[model samples]
Target: MDINIERLKSTLMELSKFGYREDDKGIYRPGFSEADFAARKWLMSIAEQEGFITRMDGVGNVIIEYHAEDVAPDTPAVMIGSHLDSVPAGGMFDGTLGVIAGLECIRTLKAQNIKLAKPIWVIGTSEEEGRFGGMIGAQALTGKLTPHQILTSHDPDGIMLSDAMRSQGLEPMEALSARLNPNLIDSFFELHIEQGPVLDQTGVQIGVVEGISGVFKWIVKLIGKADHAGTAPMEMRSDAFMGLADFAYQINRIIAEDGTDTTRITVGKAELKPGFAHTIAGEVDFTIVARDMDETVMENLAASCRKALSAIARKHKLMFEYEQVSWLTPMKCTPSIVEFIAQQAQKLKLNYQVMPSGAGHDSQFFTDITDTGLIFIPSINGISHAPDEWSHWHDVQAGTELLYQCVLTKAVNKN
Candidate 1:
């Protein structure tokens, strides 16, 4: 059990150094940002330094490989890792822990002089933070990406993904053309922070993920007349802000009453037209996001959103329109893989729980290519995507060990 817990912590800390931001209070390696490319370079340079053969696809995934003597290059390898990029002001461990732990798995396995029948590859996938609404690197590897998806995608800041990839020395079209055959990977494994209170409150050291939630997002605009704030009577004015406000007030009730307990609704952004001190707001713009673990429930939640907001707009005498931004169905991990993970936890004698992921992850994308499983460590106070985000080093070590042993055993069909 020479897993080197301190070594894992040090590697995580070192990764944190690349994407620090003073104003944001968390790491800001938004996809294709300068800091993200720096992190990418660091991953490649470090992999080479560690004596692992390094390579990249057109979408800028950094894969470090360990080839067993009898394993052919074309043989299906066991894939392990998560993404390297982060949301704006995101926590240090959100998508990073898996990659670091995968590296450690490779390190420990090589140190033990263990050889397998198949190769092992640890990847730091690029652009998984929804900056472009897709996990670019992982999808490219899984053959789930299309050239149109990349060429047409843009971040919130209006940066085209094509331009971003080119800036980092990758050709978007050619990189997509380099997609690996799905049959080449036996399975994919990822270890991540729980990012919720379940494991922390229950004192569970490991979480075997059941499935990931489906997400749907929309941009809504409420339109109304702008009038003089001092002269226009409140009763006579058709205020768009009031329309947006009314929806915000009733959203919780809508989901709770009309949808299931697992359904989640978020009004993540709001903007008032002509934001001024004394003028009546003429229009409102906002973003709506909904999530649920079941496809029908997810669709029902979407219908509920439209029902709730449209009624609010009618009552407020405001024109309303919403555009669907994205819709992704829930992804279930292979049951065999989940059971296999549970067996590993049992063998290790670690307290564990089988649970669903409220947040989407790269593992959801991997389900397209091969069996996928996720391991989660607890987040302190269930906090993530902020500078204060943390997982106890002990919990981190336990999750990593589970991942290490799982890969070493399962990659070779020893399961």
Candidate 2:
């Protein structure tokens, strides 16, 4: 049940160097980029060396299966993995740690000569960051995204996902065929950094995730007339930027009024057309990201946002449009697996807490078909998706040890 801390650290450090960035102060491996492709290749090489059968799906999900020679092929398998892609200038350990820990678990099981009733699959799902607004890789494997969807999605720079896939030597037309059959997988687990201060602040070494929050994303555009700042009177001008600013302020107020700690609203990206120092902006666009553990709360928040937009548009006399980008309902971990994780944590005498994740992860998608669970270690100061994000190596070891125990217990008990 003990993880080899030194080995885990060494593996993490080695992978950290693969997509390293000099200008950004850390790694910048965006989904489906060259750096991401290189990282996948490296992972496959490692899996091959570990005597695991490896293959990549059309959408570029890498599956490495570790088999017990005595086990029958018809037996359902246990899967442990996380994504390899990171947000621009993201932390080293967020997605990478889970994947490396999964690999390390397999290595440990092999080295210790442990036998199981089922095979183990260590997967490296692509595009969990959704940098292109489509979790194309995991979505493909889970039948959540189709080949046409992948072919049609374009980056901000106008490069199509299909082109990106072809550039990486993958066939885009076969993406739908890559969907992982629901029956093929019995259970899935992901190990991740908490990416929040709760665990570290509370002196907890591990977190057993109960659920992942739902997400509703939208782009709000305000249209007005552009005029010379000096010639336009403040009362006569329909300023798009001004209207947008007011709308953002009201959105915050709405979330505050709701008074739920889990209800969160953020305006992460914004832009103004004809951006200039001397002109009143003609058009403004901003993104809205709202999340909460409760689906009803999420729906209420979305309705409130729509109503706010309508009121703001009328007040400003500006044309308004709100387009839904995506929405995912919250997913709860399987209770039995959650209980098993809790049991294993207690057996290890590890300091742990049960909590809900504020961020979206691949486990949300996996929950659609099979039992899924998530484990978390701490991120220093709740910092993630940036160069300074970090977690202690000891915390990583503790989480991986718990993850290994949880999987072993579950795999053996499967009828």
TM-score each candidate: 0.93, 0.93
* Per-residue lDDT of candidate 1, residues 1-415 (tens digit): 6698888889889999887977866898988778998987888888799789998777888889987777777888898979999987788999999999999998898888886878899989988877777577777777777877777776544588899988888877876765777878889999999999999999889999989988877878899888889999988888989998888888878777766766788887788888886888898888887888888988777787888778887887888898775677789988999999999999989989999998888898888778899999999999997889999989999999999889989666633
Poorest lDDT segment (10 consecutive residues) of candidate 1: 149-158
Model 2 per-residue lDDT tens digits across residues 185-277: 889999999988999899999899999988877778899888999999988988899888887789777887652688889887788878999
User: After superposition on all CA atoms, what RMSD does each candidate show versus the true structure?
Assistant: 2.1, 2.1
Per-candidate local distance difference test: 0.85, 0.84
Whole-model alpha-carbon lDDT for candidate 1: 0.85
